[model samples]
Target: MRTVIRRTAVAVTAASLALLVTACGSDKPDAKKEAPAGDKGAQSSAPAAKALSTAELEKLLVEQADVPDYTVKADAKAKPVAAAGSAKADKAACQPFADAIGGTIATPAGQAVRMAVLTPKDSGKKQSPEEKALAGLNALKSPATRVLLGSYEGDGASEALNTVKNSGAECMSGFTVTQDGETTKITAATPMTLAAGEEATSWSFTMDMGGGDEAKFNLGLMRQGNTLASFYTFSLGGSVEELPIKVIDAQEKKLA
Candidate 1:
């Protein structure tokens, strides 16, 4: 009877160990199954907020002292208009082109658009060599450097950038901008290299000045949070290299 009782106790101990081992083995598969669910949860997490107010955008503009010899001021009465013959002529094709050049983006309803313009200090006064070169290249709308700052709410900045990236090729082809009774034909907008910003897109386009001579212009679009900045620089003959990069860095630092 004593031997039988001891054998029964040993058998019970063996059974308990086997059950523990089976449970441990089962837990490994359960953990492996739960890991992917945890990963999926992490993958579906919401993105960070990237909205900027108008005042914040206004503060992000490059200061006059930062870009010495340049006049940086807010355009109180500036209203962005589409390039002539755009929406009126081909609404579908022209819309994207208009947004790209005008720095216009699709924003949530009730959001206002803010803008500022930058140019050389003596843009309205005497014509400096640099000013003359820029004017000859059609880089200045009013004898200024013509950097535009636009701030949008919601996903407007991303939308504007997508328009350029997705439909730029189709919209830019045969695009024309008519100003002051003169029409300049843009043959192509080729992508250029960018050196700064969180995300940036640049292009060098050939403009038919309606003469035998053609002018080249550089357009840069940079996104910092919800703000989009545009830089336009062209020279009669000299290269306007790295100017956009400087402006982008300055603006990005301020935004940061």
Candidate 2:
């Protein structure tokens, strides 16, 4: 599983860093300024790409109408928070991934639209007493999903996606992150297969919180033209075996 958020969905208490494993887009000072490899020739003669503003990002983000069954909040309205780039990985090579999952990018000027999504706790249908009692165990595999829609300039978006791809692949063994004096240990990182956008890479991780508390989380990155979409999901019911397909599909459609 991966780290993202809890689907208990609507209410977030303190914005724990342990469940944040989603947003990772940047335009860091050191990144090269060029066009994406696939479109270099065409973009070379085009004007430099401009990032979408916060207002534009909001319009592009999902609204309750888009996902009527769940709760969605974008930008500053999204709460129980963690900032991207606030976490540091013990291995320098894995820092990009750390910042990625932490919900912030490593670059200073990268523009992004952030959101929090939660699935319904109740299935909306009347449940038998037995079903209600078993609900605790049969609850949504992933209750909360954290999202990032990052827009880039030049090749910044592609560069960000590649950085995440290389690092998520290379750091599968495990690593630790330190944010605001809190430490999170990742016991495992498992890659996943996915089809979406122009290109995508995915992973699920096991996190140990001591006291024998372990949770599985899923993290995925999808590239859509000059933008990057990152989804991180977590579960309190048990292993989050699947990504939030409904949420992802809706967001991707909005991006398209």
Q: Would you estimate the TM-scores of all the predictions? A: 0.57, 0.71
Which candidate ranks first by lDDT, i.e. highest?
Answer: 2
The alpha-carbon RMSD values of the candidates against the true structure, listed in the order shown, are 29.7, 9.3
Task: Note the Cα lDDT for every prediction shown.
Answer: 0.45, 0.59
Q: C-alpha displacement of 161 in model 2, angstroms? A: 1.0
Candidate 1 weakest lDDT stretch, 10 residues: 24-33
Model 2 pairs whose backbones collide: 1-205, 1-216, 1-217, 2-217, 2-218, 6-144, 7-143, 7-144, 84-103, 84-104
Give per-residue lDDT, candidate 2, residue 210.
72
Residues 1-256 of candidate 1: C-alpha lDDT, one tens digit per residue: 1121111111122222122211111111001111222111111123535565655555656776555323344444554333322322133554554445533445522222222123323334456777555543332331123455566555566566656655566655656644334444666666666643446666666666545656565666666655666665544333333334545566667756
- List where candidate 2 sits over 4 angstroms from the true fold: 1-11, 14-48, 74-84, 108-142
Native-referenced Cα lDDT, model 2: 0.59
